[model samples]
Target: MALEWLVINAGLSLPEGFLAYLPSLDYLHDVQASASSLSAYISPAVKASLFILGVVASLINASVIPSSLGGPGNAVLEVQAHRGGLGHRTENSLWAFAHAMEMGVSILEMDTVFTKDGVPVVWHDHDISPEKCRGDFVGAYIANLTLAEVKSLSCDGQLAEHPQAKIYQDARIPTLEEVLDLIECYDNKMVTINLETKLDPLAPNETLPVEKYIDDIVPLLERRGFASRTTIQSFDWRTLIGIKKKFPKTVIVALVELETLMSINGEYPWLGGLNLADFNDNWIAAAASIGAEIVSPGHGFPWTDTIHTPGYEPFVNEDMVKRAHEYNMRIIPWTADDEATIAKLIDDGVDGIMSNYPQRVMWVGREKNRYVPRVGTKHRPHCLVNA
Candidate 1:
């Protein structure tokens, strides 16, 4: 009753299935006693919250969180370093990942594309753009080059656009294996790796098959013993659906953009063949259909980058978060770097955020008294140096 009443107090709607998991009386009593602090934030529910993401992902299925764990005031948003904190270093480079980890980001979010020899390389664009890379490898598709050839390219060159981005002195695009090895080098067991598959359903030929992603990544994560802390996210929902059924240990995230969520190729293959209208046009519902533990939507109108135009309307709001919570799914919106946007997201009750700057999130998290991950000591890990 107290849990039910408290949900009402928070002005959060109860889904039809909300009754399936009610808090025990002991937890209810704690909530009653801490009514003062309960008003501060949903203290007791933090047990089953997205704080639940890191700890409970292995214990539960993708769709439902059957119970709560502890008293409230414990919900902490995971600060995900988008493209390995690209605002600070070259996006998805070892320098960026290490720096972001050093700053105590809970998650290092990076993108991955396959090489010609079927090796998975950490990169965003399928075709290496001259904008981020230099040397002979420029303008070549990542899939067409071997891992050795891909390594010869330099991604540390700063462009006029990323004026504030710090150069890492000839940083190379590290492989997925190298990234996992670096995490081991840091010795930070609590940190999670949110890796995205750079597979474009619109242009499938540009990248390897979805099976290769599943085959390559799952085994590699298992082999590295990082399976428990790894989150595999993709705009293509096919991987999410497959990963859940095959590699149940890995946390699957449904990454939605304004474009992916909209119909494409006269159908919705991007969404694992499900249309928006299938679930009353709900992104969270559509995500849940494919067994996603977290539903990550784009920040606003454009839904691609963090930059907002004049009078930009947001795709994420309180209602979106509430609906996600009702379905027992976590909401961690992508690419919100500004202090105001981060604060508003926290206020809206998002589970976490993806950002290009870790310091900004850390400052806001501290100011708001939200739990940020433990700070990592700086290190030039063996993986980055040898590579």
Candidate 2:
């Protein structure tokens, strides 16, 4: 009887009524026959029908099966080298960018701070942290400090303890121009760049005006033909908006966090900012409202309160990725370093990720058959030998 059902579904050569009494059938041996006998019994029309059915089913499976359903190979994890492959070399150095290229990352992520002379330099923080730099205050802003004065301070800091800290030896700060040049040298491979504009409009004594900074960077990108390869990102929504207004062709990514937005209603109006909720409960909507092409949120946002906080549910969930996709936005979470967490993000359907160690992203890519972009091509101080 079971054989009858198989024959029906398999479109095999059999009596049309053979499956009608399948529920009551007892002995399976009744249908058993030699292969030659069965082949002789199959009519040419039935054989053709069965073959056609198999082909139709195959096409249906191929068309209906989600491209992402077939194991990890279908997943595309775009690797953005945060701080220019910080795991390989010093953060934001030319060496780091070059190394990222060699590793074949999807994007090169770096921070930018303007010099006093309105020159955009590739450095991570406005005020160097005690962790990355062991030094006195260089001044309030990068725009206030000359490139020479900025270079005098040690860019390397205690990334690890003692012997493990050998990576922090001779890493020097790199200018934004130098970083852009390095990226161009790679012939603009698989890598796109996410340039964070660290300029705070609320801060006092702005060294580089918004318009001036735009003027300085846009032409350089146009000349290098990297205007399309570049993405302007900023926590400051206004800056992103400005970039959009100025360069409609270039991609602009709006960066948001739960912290600063919550503080916007505070005593100092300047410190207060736009909350994510204000944009219709969707960060993508907010970005789109300002003509942004991409939406870049931190890892575990609105899910994990602290960076180390465990039990991230929605932040790394499929639902979040689906929602972002529904909005026609790509989910590229920032600075997620853990390998397991990164894999989870890929499985959750994120479009890409920003990682300090692009190598880990590349390893996952190789295992999953995803392509990682290559970067890092410039001279750097001794500490960046690995970079």
Candidate 3:
């Protein structure tokens, strides 16, 4: 029966009468003398060989079978390298992105702020911090500097205090165009770019106007053929709304910091003037209403006290995950680096994880047998050399 099942389901043909040498069932007996006679008909060596073959066949079948055939419930969770593995390399630098691609992360997560001349550049903060960059314009905002001026700053000194700071050498800030060009030219494997549009509401006038910001980026994405491969993420739902209206084919991710949702006055700047109370404080539904394909909430630890309200404890619980999945929306918690917290989030049934150390997420996924390899790349173990 096992051989027949394999032939039918596994598309393998077997020799006719392969079991013809075996004794008929009617002649079989449980008695020791009958058993001894049975061994004579089928030699011990042949019996052992058949057993090994059956094991091999079963393994092959398991690999090819679909999830419906008693396989895992969900596909492998996506591993997004936040700011191109900021834990290991200088954040948002081309060098960091290259190392992340080499490690075969499913997504290269980055943030973008426009330069003074309206050119989109890959940078995390609106203002250049002395901690991350060194130049005459160390404390100046990217919006006030041209792309050339921004590129002159060195990112290598940003990680001077890091244990692996020596690895950071001569790295400069890269423009969004340059990053896309590198991905197109060098990376052979499939990877998603989760690019966040950085907008500051507190000082809105200092950043690019919303209309111009979208205008500048959409064309670049279309020209580079990245609209399909990239997901535009933002804390500001207005930007997500704009993208949905203009580039309907592009994917959007709604980033939510739970503390930002604790507003009782309905004035959460991050929500783009949309009140959480209007959505019953359900961020998942709110994100879905704006055509967001994914909802990314921060991991509720370390920053919880800083972001969370005194009494509110909004979190990415199992119920929230179920709600998002029901809407065909994916839930990916952002910026989790520790194993224990990551394990908890996985237990809550997140669809993916965004982390500064994506290799850690990949490792946890492998431990659970849920790690999915990149489409065009062979399975490579998580890069742990730096860790």
Clashes of each: 4, 20, 0
Compute the lDDT of residue 310 as modeled in candidate 1.
66
Which model is ahead, 1 or 3, in terms of TM-score?
1
lDDT of 2: 0.60
Query: Scored by CA lDDT, what does every candidate get?
Result: 0.73, 0.60, 0.69
> For candidate 2, what's the RMSD?
16.0
Worst 10 residues of 1 by lDDT: 63-72
Kindly list the per-residue Cα lDDT of model 3 for residues 236-312, writing each as its tens digit.
77788887888888788999885556664548777766776788877787888888888888866443332333653
TM-score of 1: 0.79
Task: State the displacement of the C-alpha of residue 92, model 3, in Å, after optimal TM-score superposition.
Answer: 0.6
Candidate 3 lDDT score at position 359 = 80
Per-residue lDDT of 57-160 in model 1, one digit per residue for the tens?
Answer: 42242212211121111276678899988888888987888888677677899999999999988898999888888879899899889998998887877867
Model 2: per-residue Cα lDDT over 237-334, one tens digit each = 76666667777877777676554444444321212244555765565666667776566677676432333456553454677667667666666777
- TM-score, one value per model: 0.79, 0.69, 0.74
**Order by lDDT, highest first:** 1, 3, 2
* Candidate 3 error regions (>4 Å): 1-73, 158-162, 303-314, 374-387
Ranking by TM-score: 1, 3, 2
Number of the candidate with higher lDDT, 2 or 3 = 3
